[model samples]
Target: MNEILTKERLIEARERISNQVKRTPILTSSSINKILNANIFFKCENFQKVGAFKFRGASNAVLSLNEKEMINGVATHSSGNHAAALALAAKMKNIPAYIVMPKTAPEIKKKAVAGYGAKIIFCEPTLKAREETLNNVIQETNAIFIHPYDNYDVIAGQSTAAQEIFAELNDLDFIIAPVGGGGLLSGTALSTKYFSPKTKIIGAEPKEADDAFKSFNDKKIYPSINPKTICDGLLTQLSEKTFKIITNTVDEILTAKEETIIEAMKLIWERMKIIIEPSSAVTLAIMIENQEKFLNKKIAIILSGGNVDLKNLPFK
Candidate 1:
């Protein structure tokens, strides 16, 4: 399979997911919508069990794995939600799970993975470290490798979020998703293109990590591994496959600064009464900062995840 996701496989993934992971609420907030002159819908994946949509991909990947591969188990390196999701999903299937995470990753996240009974491997904060460590684990156990955002199957799984969001509000004029490595954005774009052709898909990224925006604008692939952003969840450089889909389907990329992200966190707390990590807050910042553009349009923003460390409120 190709590294990037395709429209056909995204459709197949939507069909293959059998159970309701969660019918997360699609809240219509006319206030923000009206202020921007855009009708806004928030897909509350924060309310999900693990408080993130990573569960969709983890669960799908676990179920779809070949029996032999399932027996050998699965492994991946993720900072937080994805690790917890993989561990829990594998547990549900009665398979072992191995997670690799940077030592600097939040202790809360590490605890979550351990709590789910996964062996946690700590590594340095670099792509080379993550890949080399993951490779060793794979070779030793013969575990199937499930990439966080790079693989076609993973992207197809993430697309399930878009399927749910659009299913909840079929007439949205556009969709906005947090673009870390572009898994969610690519998946959503492919699915939206197939299922809701009229709906425009836009990606939201931090100004500090503007490779997606720059790459799209420059019409060239810009590679940056471990680019610095308050959105640790958005730190992964886009995969080659995900980059292609975002380049093709996403209409525009919105950039928000670290300060705007802090304000966005405060807004979600005060108005929405939801806790979101800095990564998710970046997307909200985009909406508020560019209110004039989003205003009065039928729009949906995937509140991707709520995995912030409670002690790090306001992101230090």
Candidate 2:
């Protein structure tokens, strides 16, 4: 079925974006495996185009458009990776991309999105500012809005990462991924359950930005305004569609300290030589902090993204 939000749509997105996106490698790390007392498989989405898996969802959404939609162009708001991905995807498809970004978004991300030929609209760091900016642009150009994570097509495209990971490592007892706006987590939960119903799904959220965690417990997902966290990406509230999936499919919501995130990032970089952003490293932080709980189990973790600034390396 071509219906929106259907499992078939996710499967279709997996098939449609395969050519543009990498089936990012699933790696087994001896160091991590030894420490966790479990078999660990790393789904390295950092190796994806644009230094993150955001490219997959954004590209799929942009490229699946009809000629009419393409002509109207695509508009979106992102702190960084999604903007760059959307910009690059639209450029590749010969469509104009309009990106609204928080003024405080990293300079590197801004430059990368601009470099991809997307027109940029700078806004305050509030969701209100972003939505307003996006609306103005859409009204002016009649562009189709490609939300960063809320859209079904985007979630479906993001789910493909798990499809690839589970395909390679079918015996995983659990799959752990970092949650930010719940795109990856929602996609992961749906896809993982669809393929291996027995595999437990868990999401790692920053303690500082624990909306999803609180939402899970309270049974009502609440949207917060600019929650403080070093995991910059994990600041938004869970979407309605996303919260429903997590409520039903996710076995648990895990949290990790900001300091633990830094430590985890360092360990992966120094020990395994794999670079992961603090946001991405939160999953490892969860595993490290909750070590005894995961003993002897096989786990799959998504190394979500690697867009950390080099000058901002952890203090040794």
Candidate 3:
């Protein structure tokens, strides 16, 4: 297989976005560790700018553009996090950003994207509609299309989160990340391979939105159709580029039930006193569901984002 990214590329991406992206904290809950019989470290990307790790990739994509590419600005279609991240990244560069969002996206995310000064175009809640809408926006504005997860630079940028983890900790047996379009998971897999070869990279997802899990097992790309998961951030299917990287580097893909995801999310909120969206909780859900596999192991979980609608939480 052709190499889509290199260790140098990830290092470069970290340096490129270092000034813009936050080095989010690594948090651990002793009580939770005792309960699970594992040493779990949470790479709290929920505390990241735009409240998601998407900011790293978005910043890298926007900053990688040259003068000509920046002329028309950047454009993308996202259910939530990526839209807000790209909007803020473009705004920082004093350029315009056009975002195509599903009408069903959380109101908080819609407001966040608009607050970042991006022009939002609402479309049907389907990948086809999102792609068609984004294409039209790009044609009309001549903007560069920065895909949410398919681009190499975006994947490289996402790898920095795992790189950060390796910097602070060593000999971690496994690293888990929630897989949506596979951007963060692919990046984490690459980082694990380069920085700590002994570490295994696992991708976690909601069973309701298990396209990535299915694709990984089948070795084929599958569309995410009518997925009914509360992890809104993980509703999208993986792109060819991300799928290729994931199939090659990722060690395993695991799925969590919807109720288990909610339980894990609530557990983190109560134990760590930190807010995490359902998407982030999928990692913990998998650990909770497969306790034997991770027993006494050192693990790192990437809390993908905290961009949930407060009034519409899954909990009572």
Candidate 4:
């Protein structure tokens, strides 16, 4: 009964973060539907606070903390939207936030995190360095560590995105999301399982960072090392909790080449008139790669984020 990954827990998370978070809109593209010969629904989380869905989980984690937990604030290591999200969420709670960022991270992301009043600590780009830096920050400040995608509260919070999708439209034949650390995909799979049992949960992964695809098929976790994909948000490997949920509930993991990802991202901007990060384009790329499977089906695509460094775009 105390399980945090259950439907009840997700529902509770929805209630908790409802007042603080925006209920992002769902958009449809007639042109894209014609191209794919399928009715595709896009849950646009790009419009979410901090320009990403990471805010939902971060806010949930921050808001869920007890009074004792709040006194020491929170700490996290992320070079993308998660850092900004956690920092902003902690600011909302009127508490201190310690953020560990790689020195090589984009200046935009660094600015976003600092703008939220978090104390930023620079570290080497490697995961080992980030973890070591974050550990030291936590040790020094006694801040609760809020992992980007590994915590149960974070997963439960992420599930609310799919809940909103089902609430608006429930006849989806397939629900697809990009798999980074498996938080969004696993959360989506659980939501689809409860709300639309017939819907297949599919994960879109970059071939350059295809650890999730490999792990899903191999039934084991694999390290993501020096990934050469433009999907910066998805460079991290899956956590044990995420891997377990994904293997159990997800129907499949499809991978897309770098070219396909860039092409899909450009197409969305041109057709849908929406800005999406490369990580978000992975889902559309998967649909394009496997057109036969998705043709004539009603599919839902979760656009993970819109946080892109405009100065460094993959497409012209």
Best model per lDDT: 3
Q: Write the per-residue lDDT of candidate 1 for residues 1-316, one digit (tens) a residue.
A: 2334556666667676646377688776545555456677788888876888888778778877878779999999887788888898888888889898988986788888999999999999877899999999999988888888777777788888888876767777778899878888888888788778898888999998988888888877787654777787887667778878788889999999989989877867766777777788787789878887765677888888888777667644
Q: State the lDDT of candidate 4 residue by residue for 1-316, as single tens digits.
A: 1255777888899999999899999999999999989999999999999998899999899988999999999999988888999999999999999999999987888899999999999999888899999999999999999999889888888889999999999679999999999888878888888778899999999999999999999999999978999998899899998999999999999999999999999999999999999999999999889999998999999999998877777776
Which residues of candidate 1, in runs, are more than 4 Å off?
Answer: 1-8
Least accurate 10 contiguous residues by lDDT in model 3: 1-10
What TM-score fits each model?
Answer: 0.92, 0.96, 0.97, 0.98
lDDT of each: 0.80, 0.86, 0.93, 0.91
lDDT of 2 by residue, 112-228 (tens): 999999999999987789999999999999999998788877888888999888677777799998998898998898888888778899999998889899888888987765577
Worst 10 residues of 2 by lDDT: 1-10
Score residue 138 of candidate 2 by CA lDDT: 99
Poorly placed runs, candidate 4 (over 4 Å): 1-3
Candidate order by TM-score, decreasing, is 4, 3, 2, 1
Better by TM-score, candidate 4 or 2: 4
Candidate 1 vs 4: which has more lDDT? 4
Q: What total of clashing residue pairs does each candidate reach? A: 9, 0, 0, 0
Which candidate gets the maximum TM-score versus the true structure?
Answer: 4
